[model samples]
Target: MADMQIDSSPVRTVNVTRYVTPLREGGSLPAIAEADDGFLYVLKFRGAGQGVKALIADLLGGELARALGLKVPEIVFANLDTAFGRTEPDEEIQDLLKASVGQNLALHYLSGSITYDPAVTVIEPKLASQIVWLDCLLTNVDRTARNTNMLVWNKELWLIDHGASLYFHHSWDNWAEQSLRPFVQVKDHVLLPQAAELDEVDAAYRAMLTEEKVRSIVELIPDEWLTASASDAIAADRREVYARFLTARIASSEIFVKEAQHARKSLI
Candidate 1:
């Protein structure tokens, strides 16, 4: 991002102690695992189909959501031991673990959380607007009602599963033209009906997400995850591009905010 020094207090390293169970909802196949710190974490493997870029998005996205005062599980650096793979009896999981025996990402497990249900849950309009605003700013396309990727732990909503964001990076050729693209998926956002202060939420978050704050989140991405070829000028500064995109989106949030607001009206 910028040349400013980023604080590293958010990055914590933990050793993977045991593989618990597989969460097969998405293609990534992330699993629940116990770590050396005596806490269970939902480990996101680097070798999964989405590869390193997904991990990068997960880290940065979670941090950005937290910055906007949203509740997010703690993310940590998971150090996988090569031998851990040999203990697995399942061939597919064994291969996956063997391939991911190094620094990976993990989200602290919420011991007893329920998936969000709009039919029963009563979300504050402000919180819903903030959530819709954050998802739009990040261009996250995975927050629809069918796949909310949100959890209700201790009777509070918590954000999770941010890897689906920054999908623009998948095909870099015409990325620039699509950088300022509108988020059409807001129409299906699960919390749209509960959102009543899109403009206020947008303004507050825009003011809060300064260059340094965005850069700090970008900096949390491990260097190895920024693996795109440095030969391309844009690829060389992959971190910078991510931060710039977020800052740009924040500056240009009016269109998306209006879209969200319009979607809210359409519900009436």
Candidate 2:
């Protein structure tokens, strides 16, 4: 998180004006839709197989990346009307749209961007370290060689599809304990071999992501999204849980940092 900058600007809200096409590449079946703002966005449906928890992960992970001065697509809250996708021929997509009629999540589409091919594109150690560190902090398990959830937009790396991050929330049984554990998945991170600056970035990132800042990022999650996932847990209580977990995790960054370093040693 060197040269750290926090984008505290609240996420914008948009209305989905049209459902252009579905992006079948992602298992969630996210689509490219045009919003009232006259921009194309990759819409992540609430009714997707992963459900609202995935939306929550997207918001948290994307915003946290932004907060840490990483390159991430603009995220927005999209409202889908009840009659949005009725005319569609596909029953599965139609039902998906119907079920996602309320609020959803979307990333401002980066047109003309190409998927990051590690073999062709080279990443400097610092940038690679930053990405690896961010994923470790969030315990993200998706950024692998097979499906590197990264893009080369404007010849720079842009992270996307964070719906698979923060997986501990899927079964909130031991979230607190899970937070302090090392992210063993860092070994498989697409950028691990290039992430030679893990130790250099760890302290700066931890200092930048203070408890207040972490809570602010967690608070960006919509109340309905939290309540939808946890019928028994109050939204406020859940927010605090996330805040505490992230804060504790950051405080223990040394643990994961060491693990990532060890993994990198094995690679080199």
Candidate 3:
């Protein structure tokens, strides 16, 4: 599974050589940092309030989107050094850097991108439905009108900030049953009104996401992120749990698709 490839490319890894400004808008305090590749990336620290769980969500959700032919910034493994942020003056930022001195997750920074504005930008029904379907599949509760978590770059909609997706993992209980349930939060989706093609795109999207593909994405999650949590077997088995949960959720995507369609009807 370690050699598995999505699009024949695995997520690349980079060393965080410089700490840039922090993106304070996020509760997790993700930063825009420079990597050893000489490219800038939006770093999602493993030591934030959401910890490694959020990073896992980011990786899983982003890769799932990419698998479905959506535009997501390139996700990467960011190695943070112990002495990375010693020069920072702020106490809070300093501590965050110190605790996050290990493997973290990051996305290629989309420079000069603007947050998606629903009032101005009009998305085609198919694309809108696809994005809505994706949010439903991930049970993402963050794509509300208040916080779109989307960006308009080069006149295209690119997804970002999926750390808020797969919220079920935060509690880590009854994951199987949770995967079978509907995503009731579909009602709050920003694109629900325009996602009129939900029914049309359902089958095609499901076909695109195979169990092996999902497991490959799950396998991308580092062992440290899985084992860093609990002392119990649940921690050791976390990766398998994620793979099973996603495959189950994809198998039962109709439950959430119907939920999204019904929610869309209400909006119109």
Query: Where does candidate 2 clash, by residue pair?
Result: none
Candidate 2: residue 48 Cα off by (Å)? 0.3
Q: Report the alpha-carbon TM-score of model 1 versus the true structure.
A: 0.92
Among all windows of 10 consecutive residues in model 1, the one with the lowest summed lDDT is: 1-10
Tens-digit lDDT string for candidate 1 (101-196): 889999888888999988888899999999999988878889888898999988899999899988888876666556677788888899999899
RMSD in Å for model 3: 3.6
Superposed on all Cα atoms, model 1 deviates from the true structure by an RMSD in Å of 4.8
lDDT of 2 at 11: 85
Q: Compared with the true structure, what per-residue lDDT tens digits does model 3 show for residues 1-268?
A: 1121235258888999998899989898999999888888899999898899899998999989998999888889999998899999999999999999899999888888999999999999999999999999998889988999999987989999898888878777888999999999899999999998987788998888888888888888888888777756454488888988888988988899988888878889
Q: How much is the lDDT of residue 187 in candidate 1?
A: 89
Per-residue error for 185 in candidate 1, Å, reads 0.8
Candidates by lDDT, descending order: 2, 3, 1
Give per-model CA RMSD. 4.8, 3.4, 3.6
Q: Model-by-model lDDT, in order?
A: 0.84, 0.90, 0.88
- Candidate 2: lDDT over CA atoms? 0.90
Q: How accurate is candidate 3 locally (lDDT)?
A: 0.88
Q: Which is superior by TM-score, 1 or 2? A: 2
